[model samples]
Target: MTDYKLTEYSHKAGCGCKIAPADLEKILSQRSGTSFKELLVGNNSNDDAAVWDLGTGMSVINTVDFFMPIVNDAYDFGRIASANAISDIYAMGGKPIFANALLGWPMETLPLELAGKVMDGARKICEDAGIPIAGGHSIDSKEPLFGLTVTGLVRTENLKRNNTPEIGDVLILTKQLGTGILGTAIKRKAAKEEHAKAAIDSMCKLNSVGAALSQITEVHALTDVTGFGLLGHLMELCSNQVSAEIVWSQVPSFPFLDEYLALNIMPDNTTRNWNSHELKVDGLIDLKAFQVLNDPQTSGGLLISVAPSKVNEVMALLNADGLNHAAIIGAILPKQSKTVLIK
Candidate 1:
């Protein structure tokens, strides 16, 4: 409630603060861990969460995500960050059981009361998701940061993987894009209030439908679109087994995106996202297109891969669940020289 803007205290906003995907790959490539048989999902794949089978037809899902302020309001930032972290569990088709807060604050500049408001906001979202912030760790830092380490559970048979979609599966995005550009606009004090609020609303909405989606027999693969942008995550979903055909116009985006794009408003990470996977893409003709494709998102949406025969059925489910922006943007196909081609 003070005049201090949280964005001014940090260099990057939201998921834009994430490391570039290509370099993250380089770092992960050198990682070594026990190859336990019960580990159904691990860092070996670019999955939303690590799933460990519990030997009772169920599995436990584990993940942690955090970021600096993407909005000026401390309360909204906490809600968005917590929603982003808990989304990994939903993306994996799990119902969150509990969460532990992770916080980093600058006591030298920001007040302790502001940090308390953040905790209050996060607790609200966790409660809305039917969970609690049971515990956490905190530290005094140079800048402010917050998120959650969420734990969830799912039937082993219903676990979703990003790389296991069928070649003919239809690709569905459950939320509109443009959070990065809008958030950047807010940071620069160029965004209209309505546009900034729209982005925050998108980020704060929980991807809880992911749990219900897993129950559908036709749903094949799932992953949330976050920092890496749509194309980066599509690359992971495509892997080497298949390629993707994205219909550019059909891709859902915030209606105000073009208004901001005219001013060249965009997150700094947009180019970083493009450079990471440009070699594997085609049919991208200009900077405008690249900006939309590679814009980093914080607590964005679910990218659901489903059997083509179930497209209508899935759309109905999404609409009923309040994801009206959800649309069939593309389809998975046999592997191509380029992993993703858009038109």
Candidate 2:
């Protein structure tokens, strides 16, 4: 067994062991009276990255993401986690400029060598993204934890917003769904090496492709799917004037995911997300049908909304560059009372 530091054990890791959904709801609801500022992108909309206008030509994009070891390999885990965090920058049509490490290590249980591997993995990803690791802070805890606080630069003209999904837009998702379910399976030893490897590769893949998306003026809005899952993120895109229809069959999914679901290995968050949006999705489709679709993602792909006429060109660009998993998943429609529909 490993050795690690001791802390007052209320929870195992930082943010990984998030407070229960019910508790979080109650807490957030109690603070609904807070006011918003012109430049502040507050929690009200569940935005992926916060934007701060610096001045004339540029803006600052800030986001922080952290989680526990979804896989056992320290180096691989760090690479995936760092990629996941940096994805937010690209999702918002920004270039990551620098990153600061966020870590919680069990100094008494886990060896420093393992922690070093984690940083090494993160460093490699930073190198790939053309970003720098400026500096960071760490804590001693009962469980190993790792992630990054990334800052990116966005020109005023290039920034993407999650709330700007337009009615004439088409939806595209860059990678397959089911990482969360597959990850749960791995933790339970119910998945094979191939399945685990697929999930790892997807999680470690960067969103530099999304930067190309910014050049397409018709690409209206974007966000990266992670902990909350696709349905959760889609609900945030819905507005009184615009809604979305998801072609469930067109969505890319993992190879053995159907088999895993057949074996009942879906993660609990999948259902939690559905229940949270049950009101918005009531008659749009059978809620019971999507336990696999709504599964939480770890470093998932960009979910972009582009002008319907531009879909082919976008797909062609992604394909020519070897982004084989990229596909047009749905279209934005004139808003209906239901907000979202799955066909």
Candidate 3:
């Protein structure tokens, strides 16, 4: 057996390698010539995945996600990446039927055996999700990458979206934040054992609960927090005629984040995320809160907006399902020119 440090070969870790929001918008904006009426959810909405209305009470959801390794262990990286990819389906309140793997490997630098380990890890997660890896594509690259293109089914009425939050709806975050900060610290060899374990556990956990919540009528909007961080994704939910009020104290986060923030060990994506919409954000956002808000997450958690009356029920369900870190973080509010208000 050979010891391999996967994160060393990559310049950026996990979702932090995503294109900047501004750059992504610019690229997406260039494609203005196409439109499809059957597409219930498309690039126009910034939703998690593209959903095609089957017109028979069911919709098909498709999403693809890939990223560089955030951890040294090939198995952990594969598990995290696979969970992150399928999360888009769950975010839309869909059940994954199957998936196809996407692999990018540095064949000249790394052995094929490590790639097999990655595939094995992905297969395990798929099995946990009760889906199969039908097939996939691979490519020779400079850095290792693994993910999935998942196909899922959702009842038309059960579909959830990011942009339809009703006012007075309470926000729920399923997992604790701070993966990006911890990943950065880990890369720098500054993270503690406890912090690393917490991050890895959170990253590998699936957001399948989002699918269950989708069946609840009170659950209005849903989104999985990923490389964009909680605030970035919440902003998506607040886009257009909606705004959000986030209670700083109520937000759930990893316990060791204060130590990492003090050391100024944060991911580079934090700034990029903030720069993308800082002007649209109101309220007091200080240095520490800024880092926490914009810190990218790998397979983070689902941010759910449920009716205030059902908040307790939703929280209880999440807790009963072993998602104890779930917390009522904020509420949707009427638009006030700003998309998000942190207090």
Best by lDDT: 1
In model 2, what is the error at residue 329, expressed in angstroms? Answer: 1.3
lDDT of 2 by residue, 159-203 (tens): 887778888789999888888887777666687999889888888
Q: Rank the candidates by lDDT, best first.
A: 1, 3, 2
lDDT (Cα atoms) of all candidates against the true structure:
0.93, 0.78, 0.90
Winner of 1 and 2 under TM-score: 1
- Encode model 3's per-residue lDDT on 1-343: one tens digit a residue: 7688898889999999888787788889866657888899887779999999998999999999999999888988899999999999999999999999999999999999999999999998899899999999999999998999999999999999988899999999999999999999888888898889889999888888877898799999999999888888987898869899998888899987989889889999999998988888987547877888889999999999999888888887899878999998889999887889999
lDDT of 1 by residue, 1-343 (tens): 4677899999999999999998899999987877999999987788999999999999999999999999988889899999999999999999999999999999999998899989988998998999999999999999899999999999999998888889899999999988999889988999999988888989999999999999987899999999999999999999857999999989999998888899989998999999999999999996667898899999999999999888988899899989989988999999999999998
Q: What is the lDDT of residue 79 in candidate 3?
A: 91
What shift in Å separates residue 339 of candidate 3 from its native position after superposition?
1.5
Give the top-scoring candidate (TM-score).
1
- TM-score of candidate 2 relative to the true fold: 0.90
Query: Per-candidate TM vs. native?
Result: 0.98, 0.90, 0.98
TM accuracy, model 3: 0.98
